[model samples]
Target: MEYRKIFYNVSEKDMSFEDVIDRLKTFITADPRSEYVLSVGTDSHVHAKDTKFITAIHLHRKGKGAWGCLQNTFINRQINSIHEKISIETSLSQEVAYHFTSDYLVELSELLIPFSDEGADLTFEIHLDIGRKGVTKDLIQEMTGRVLAMGVEAKIKPDSYTAFGYANRYTR
Candidate 1:
């Protein structure tokens, strides 16, 4: 079970779910004055027989530097439908986002409230690959709606770097 949840961090060794949360806590505490955004997104690449999906969880400290990790999932067969791909991507992101439940987010936010004077803040988001452009335009409503129902902020297209950039990088 632990093996399945291991997330690969480029700047450091691989980490478990617990390790990632602990690291984020340390990062936020080290400088409570910085703004933080914890975002999750997923992107995929299709192969001849299968597709490789990469979901990234990014902890960004506003103008400052940040930390992140990736989890990869592979489907046994190619997914030709745009809807299918988008749905799967959102599902993967949901899996990661759900880990940060309401209670967990409150705990994390409590850490920053004390340093609010130093501009300390946090935003949680789920970035979707589908946008209002190209072939994905039709999916904008459904996909974003799915994320919104989770009670976390939802971002798309130009604003969704976690899926468009971070996870996309490794999917290829």
Candidate 2:
């Protein structure tokens, strides 16, 4: 059931969307001078009976440190189509990014305004599971287009650690 969504990370677990926003705000203020990247991504693994999808929302304070949270979705059936699987993954990432509305961005940006001259900034990204290499190549435009259409940046492959790295780690 997608009714009550919750996100969990190492420092905290079972958090709501508002809670994630609050924690992220705290993380930013904790080191206001650092550049930040807020990313959303999803990855999936198919098992004998089901396909498990893990969506991750990550906040990075440059090279110093980072915090992330993830939520899982399951389909009680194998996802044989690469298109379908990757499509769902992209959708999940979009769902998370959609929560960070223009108002939220303004608030987040205001937090970094003071340190902007020092290179402190905020970037919002939607990480797609599709890439420029391998079978995912064909779907790059379509998937990335979906994300870009939402007025957010999209990253894939070697650059998209959120989907291919963070979320992938938990899909297992």
Candidate 3:
């Protein structure tokens, strides 16, 4: 039920959410520990990749399951719901963020466990890169403020890092 939220930043040229998801899929496939989930929140720029990609991946290794939610949208409504439940908000971009709590993470983990057993450990990851400028820190701060107004824990990170961290391998 305990989950860790890690953030990172990367470049935004010739990169899309799909690229991140593909890398994650490759990572899961190579690892022996099957139970895990990978989620990628992208900007609006990389939304249309003309591919039938999976939105989430489930890694089932042994009896453990890890569920990854590839969220593309982080509107006020979603943030408020997560803040109310978990008190933790993960912002990938000014426009895309996700909130996860112990209970919800546990639920996600449970949902993904079965996939591992059936050799379906990897699920499709979501992309949210919208390819727009002006989604700056101020916007994120505003969003965070709104979440806090609702009595929820919220934070914001640079969109560049969220989109390209995998390729850059920069630690957040």
Against the reference, the lDDT scores of all candidates come to: 0.87, 0.88, 0.33
lDDT of 2 by residue, 27-132 (tens): 8888887888999999999999999999999898889889899999999999999999999999988887877854477788788745446668899999988777
Q: Which window of 10 residues has the lowest lDDT sum in candidate 2?
A: 110-119
Best by lDDT: 2
Task: Report residue 36 deviation for candidate 3 (angstroms).
Answer: 7.0
Measured on C-alpha atoms, candidate 2 has an lDDT of 0.88
| Residue 165's lDDT in candidate 3 | 36
lDDT for model 3, please. 0.33
Model 1 TM-score, 2 decimals: 0.92
- Candidate ranking under lDDT, highest first, comes to 2, 1, 3
**Displacement of the residue 28 alpha carbon in candidate 3, Å:** 8.7
Worst 10 residues of 1 by lDDT: 1-10
At residue 57, candidate 1 shows an lDDT of 90
Best by TM-score: 2
* Model 2 misplacement above 4 A: 1-3, 116-118
TM-score of every model?
A: 0.92, 0.94, 0.26
- State residue 112's C-alpha deviation in candidate 2, in Å: 1.6
